[model samples]
Target: MPQNKKFGTFAGVFTPSVLTILGVIMYMRLGWVVGNAGLIGAIVIIIIAHVIAVTTGLSVSSVATDKKIGAGGIYYVLSRSMGIPIGGSIGIALFVGTAFSIALYLIGFAESFNAYLGFGTTISDLRLTGTIALSALTILALISTSVALKTQFIILAAIGISLISICFGSTEFVPTTVHFFSTENAVPLEVVFAVFFPAVTGFTAGIAMSGDLENPKRSIPRGTLYAIGVGLLVYLFLAVFMAYTIDAEVLKTDYNILMKIALFAPAVVAGIWGATLSSALGGILGGPRILQAMSMDKVTPTFFSKGKGQNNEPVNALFLAFVIAEVGILIGELDIIARVVSMFYLTAYGFINISFFLESWANPDFQPKFKVKRWIGLIGFIACFTIMFKLDMIAMIAALAIISAMYFGLQRKEVKLQSNDVWKSVWENVVNKGLKRIDAQVEENSNWNPNIILFSGKSDHQKYLLELCKTVSGRTGIVTNFKLILDKENSKPPLKKIDQIVRDEQFKDLGIFARQIKVDNIYNGIKNIASTFGFSGVEPNTIMMGWPKGIENSEEYSKMTQALIHLDYNLLYLDFDRVSKFGNYSSVDFWWRETDSKNAEMMLNIARFIIASPRWNDTNIRVLFVNNNNVDVSIIETKISKLVEDLRVNVNIKIINNAVEQKTFYTIIEEESIATNLTIVGIPDFNPEKQAEFVLKTNSLFESIGSTLLVKAAQNFNELDLDLLNK
Candidate 1:
């Protein structure tokens, strides 16, 4: 049997969030924000900051409805969507911000308390009393969260009474001139916003109590958004009242303006302290819960995971929180803590939006009852990050560095329970974007990125052949390890083997997939998948294969090549040997055949790709031509320059003017490519009967020239108005 839930929205979320929103800042610094920013600028700052919070609230609501929202609230949602490392980092940061905020709010309570008691608002006086208040709140929070939250009900009543009295204190409508913008107080609006933004961020106070909630998924969204709405209304009323009734200079200097102008001044003073003390209590309670959640997640050390007291209270976490709060007290300034806290909170908010955005975009299972436009998350991300940079660059960088360090550290540890996240969604979208860019400009020569489909009989046996194709494909294109099983049924073909090859650790950076197809004939299976290969934005543009074993097998190879080439697939035939020879890679020998630059375009480009890889790092890419002197050297140089210059890669050009026969051609291959591991050659036009024999002899002749890749340009077929390719 389970214990019943003991709290609802009003007590659990709204009271805490509203108290914190109307905390030290509203009582002490909203006047300063208004003074520096003026009436219009103050309203602008409030709206912009709240818009980000409200948008994040909406995103939170959207994500909460999609799944069984867990104990960590914002951290849970972020982890479930974006992955643990990132969510855990932000969760810890949020905990620190919450802990530090306890000190900030206590200091506010002490300052206002000292003034009410007829003592001047001195730093030393506030620090002494603030430490005492911190001690009291830590005891109350550790007593039980329920008891602490119950006390917030009383604080809420005091704040409400104070608000009512404040309205009654000023209905004169003196109509002080409200400037659109101002720096009359010698304070920048960005600085003023940094002071005020922390107010609305307290809406997450309820979310941090997610572990203790009855129906967290339902309660969290309701509580947080309600807090934001109520806070907005109260601040709007105060802003308008202050703008119409009080003079700008007076508003600027008065830290206790609410107490000074309220109908019942003493009651307002109690309300200010009540608001401050409640916010400190809320932070004290929430901060520990966040820590406990992180510890349970195993992102932090597990020592903080224990909840020893009755009703499973976070005693150990609360002790740590108290220790941190004491350290915050040593800093002895509310405004400094306020600014730093704002940075962490804003960073958390940015990730919240990012998590939601990724959840919606990546996961098809992510169907929330409450839907928002995708742009809302995007806007929230921009707003939070923008305001953070505007407030303080150093603080923002420091916060990000801390989060990044935590993310990497957790990632390094490799937690045992791996939950699915939007990592696939992120990479899939990246691959999709590249495909879309390629698809959109199919007409342009330069826009093409290779998508090679290899007709590998048992590709895993010679994985390096596919790797060479992958390196040539370079991260931009897709590489499929295809196996043709000779049967009608499409049964499995050692899927673990296929998966191993597809996820080859060495070539993980490239786009790779695996498939095993069964057909009566190899050509039909190759043709069928190739015709329908890939999703939108990507399709097979090239076909690669190892040179067949026998002279009798040449007909099938030629047919496969022609059929795919007819589909506009650029074809390459690899005559393999070893990848490394001569003790370090040498050069790529590219046989530049036609002057149209169209025929040898892909060959030249592939040679460039080969030499660029880590395996062939600094290997020279020389453009070799069997020149009969028909094409001028200057014409060839100009064309090569135009092509290679745009590529921003290096290459060398060589002319072989010897009237080359097949005998001399094989000699030229051996001599010119002696230091090279790979030679790139274009398949010349020849009779079908004789071509196979010619290729077999050519392969044998260049066997010592290392591995040779024979190329034929399919793009030239489309350029030549070939009708078979269009089909």
Candidate 2:
């Protein structure tokens, strides 16, 4: 176990997050936002931005409390909750954006430093100053993170002094009245949101330090929520105070209006520099650890993953971060497109919300102590993405595109899978609960649809049976390709090639589910699966099998048939003599036998299922009966006519008045079935003691028919089949 250096909640999480939250935006831009958007609009903007922060904070806390959040902070919670692919994409984007954020702050610091010292200097000279300051901060970070965090306390004190001066001078600089909603000469509402939005963006600064914290799981939630609460109240107070005290014109144009609005102007000036520098320090400190963690995971170059510093700081990672920041400083004028860079952070926040939502929705083991309603995460996800697009749709989209590209690139590296998150288990729970409920409800005949499991031996050889499965299944029913492995060791059979064949475009119109299950024997396998193959509102109610071919022992298949009978399953056995032989279906034969035969109804149902498809559109169905001489033809003909009328299917009925000898029945069927493409027959007997004889006799029926379907209908097949069986 990798251990973290121990620290309390305030130093490890609260101080960093709070100081960053109260950074350069609070000092330089809050007044401008209030001036442009007016009191209420600024308040609205602040609330909108902070609502995202507050909700994200809650989501982060909930995830953190449930998991041991070590190295990688927000990425830890995310990667643990979601998978590595999603987390790595968002994590890398966040690290780059955050690393670039250091350059942004340092540039601000350079300009402010130049103006404060009254030096009339060129932009290049200011760039040099910013580069030097960044290098120094990087060194400080490499020396020790604890030291940098300690320095933030002093900076926080300066911010406190500035806040006091600004509030005190609010009363001193006030006019008698104020306009709450004035937007005279203000920028667009989108621009106003853009200006004020960064105020809440620093909320995740603490999350970057997840590795170094003693009790990260405990500290992250308490510290993050506290910072957001503090940040929200402080922003609201400043927005309201600035609206009433300062003139709108000065607030709009003057970036340093806070200095003039302060009772002690120099203290607020110090606060501005202090806040910007501290915010830069926070990013500089946090960025390396993220890189270091990713390196250890082998997502990035492993050299940066291990630090060489005695204090256990990420020395190599810090230098590499410095290299990136220095390059940004050299690039100069990064400020013009700084807003675009912020897109990555917003996208990262959105992903954070999505991660928590997926965990809560899918993972059954996600028992967080700080549970919020699931919609909170969902709303936060929407809000973040919405705000991102609203600001710069192109930049937001481009950032996502790059992240997705990076995700695929990283996936090629083959990172080890390590998430213990519960999302998949939760999905299983949902499916199982849904199916149990469905099974409990009374099944109606109108709602009945075939959810057939096809046991086609080497499905490739039985193309006719496969096509029949598709046809009988129709659009409303399900057809699954089930392959049983008959091995004692339960080894996985090579089924990918065959799966690809089924998944090919030639069979694209067919909706079929496929799985290969391993068991010691075939009958036990079928029994186990027939009893349990179901999900959500679907269950395997019917078993469709081709005529058994490669069976060395027929007793196993006999047991399988017996098991299905006991389980009350509808069984379909087909003898497919090649699909090419079914070139054009001219006729479908439904054999009507005894008056009370259950097979008659099921065979007719099967015939109906096939003829409804466009493949059999030109075919006419024939209901033929070879009756005994003593039977009345007109009475049975009338009964058949009524059955056809109730079913609404086109059929021609034919009665053979001459009786045939029982010994020559096979020869008679052989001649009569020559013109038909498909013959449907019902089996009435399953002699339990004579399973082998029954199997042989049943197999003999296919010798005369072209593509024969032998159905053994269940006795209690809902109300409709029960009524048919009783009659």
Candidate 3:
């Protein structure tokens, strides 16, 4: 929130321009392609690159103006407009691409150094130069990222001075070259696009500075488009200069092609060398913010998102990016690096274009202020896809393979609960799709049912739960109600000198009754509370109750109060894990009697409810939708399809049509309990009082039998609404 925690107008424009310079410099390596294609091909490439940059920038800025953007800004747009999963994929792709670009930039750094030092005569010296540059870059990255963006002002200024020198000094070095007498081809047209595609990209790098910009919408569009146009002009000027001044044959075989031009005019070498260094450092300092955003959104681990140093920079991810780039620098395969980086950005941009169209189709309410006429969005999509196909297919496939793995891997943790109606679907997804960290504590108690106990020593505890119960029950219109027992008789120590203590211990018990009806007798009041909390105009089934923690003699009371409270109040003990640890729920095992169990659909839904809790996240889930298997395959498939389609948890289906699969299924449950950290078993038995005892025993085993839970799926689910589940 400090005002100075942002980039100035010049700095904003400078960052993306640096990235653009880094990208465009690749044409030097691909000069033969430009030389072969003649001026027309060069013109076409420049025009297409500009159009892509302008249209994409406009599309991005259009969204930026309407929303308060963050460093993780683009994903917010993608998630809100499309959905979180696809947004997550784009987040990963963008980060990986930017990180890899640092490597490509470093390779350029080493080559520039080799050319200036004239060390390419020996292979070992070339490797040493690459090593020295990469090490220096790694250290520089750590320093620049350690401070706030304000400290980078001096660095940016130096870069500007250097660029000016390169422009002015190079004019005197222009050498006359004879025109070609015959036409000849070297690299194919497809190969030229493949190599130069990454070089002409990265205008969107400015968007990562959104968190540091005063008016990102206005600034990002102007800065991004201007940087692209200016970078094109710069590239064109340098390309023309190098073409006329340097020998084409020498440039083709030379690693330090730019340095040769700088050498021809001694005054320009220092300026161009400094310009290349500034371009590398500028990218190093800015790109990791996007990675930090990606990590915060769960595309990567949480470590990258944590604030570091007094400035709260995303230091971990920044350093990680540099380290990855260094490894890439050591390999120094320009073709492989270029191909990978292109595939990364193109894949992400392709989605950006699709989300534009999907937003119009699925969410008509999202209207961009600066619309890229629908056809332009379509054109952008085609251009991105076409470029993607022409790039290295092997690289594209490899990038996608990694992305898809992370996509589903991360999706398991992002599931949220809806209404009680979806509880079964939720449960199924968690068991089937969630991430499971191996923990002995949870594994031991996997079969044990932890009671769903709500607490109310403080008035807020009961109030929040009561409101939630009403919300859940109202939506499902099912009989999901809870019991309230106020312990007014609990001893309160006498205060000294007749001092009064302000507290509301008894208010907890009487709070539910205060809503509409008052019960004079606490015993009969339990039933009345149940009816009131239960779905109105519907038969009562489940009553939710809060467990008192941090109070003495509460455990005994928790056990004794269940029978009096209502055999229906299934006690659920909530686990509130840290936000960083939040993820998928592991193991949703349903107990089904042949007649009543087909509601395995309902049971899968219950697991999703468990996942919404912070405690169960980042845990793997096992879904048991049991069928006695006497039912037809078509019916089972219908139920299974619905469960998979609707629920978002990791699921495994078990069909116990006979005693054989049933025995195997039960054994599987034991094995699952040992393997996973948590287990959920639906209350298959029907005796309310006996079920209450089962719930109590299950809660007692929280420490010994494995971290297990028992939910009366049928009892409480009837009252939950479908819409208010996540809230």
Q: Tens digits of per-residue lDDT for model 1 on 323-381?
A: 88878777777778778778888998998888888788767778888787778998898
lDDT of 2 by residue, 103-122 (tens): 76777677667777876447
Error of 3 at 357 (Å): 3.2
- For model 2 the TM-score comes to 0.75
Measured on C-alpha atoms, candidate 1 has an lDDT of: 0.76
- Which residue runs of candidate 2 sit more than 4 Å off their true CA positions? 1-5, 118-129, 170-177, 182-184, 323-338, 360-364, 367-375, 389-414, 447-449, 456-538, 549-568, 578-727
Query: In what order do the candidates fall by TM-score, top score first?
Result: 1, 2, 3
TM-score to native of every candidate shown: 0.88, 0.75, 0.53
lDDT of 3 by residue, 1-727 (tens): 5434556545665454554454425423545444543435544665665566555655666666555567765665565454556667777777767777766665655565666666572445545665676567657656655243444454445545544554454344343662232136344555655656666666665676676676676676667667776777765665565556555555445544443434234433443444445555555655677777766666667898886554456778777877776666666766567667777877777767666654543343455555555555556677777766665667667776876876676578673222121123334445433323222124331211222222223343444444433322332323222233344553543233223222234434323322222234443555444444422222244434443234323444434445533564543333221231112344334444443342444555555555554444444545444444456645664555555555565655554445345553345455545434445554445444464454444444333324343444434333222121122
Per-model RMSD to reference: 4.7, 7.1, 16.2
Minimal lDDT window, size 10, model 2:
718-727
Off by over 4 Å in 1: 119-121, 169-180, 183-185, 416-419, 425-447, 455-464, 483-502, 509-536, 552-568, 579-583, 594-598, 611-617, 629-650, 659-663, 715-727
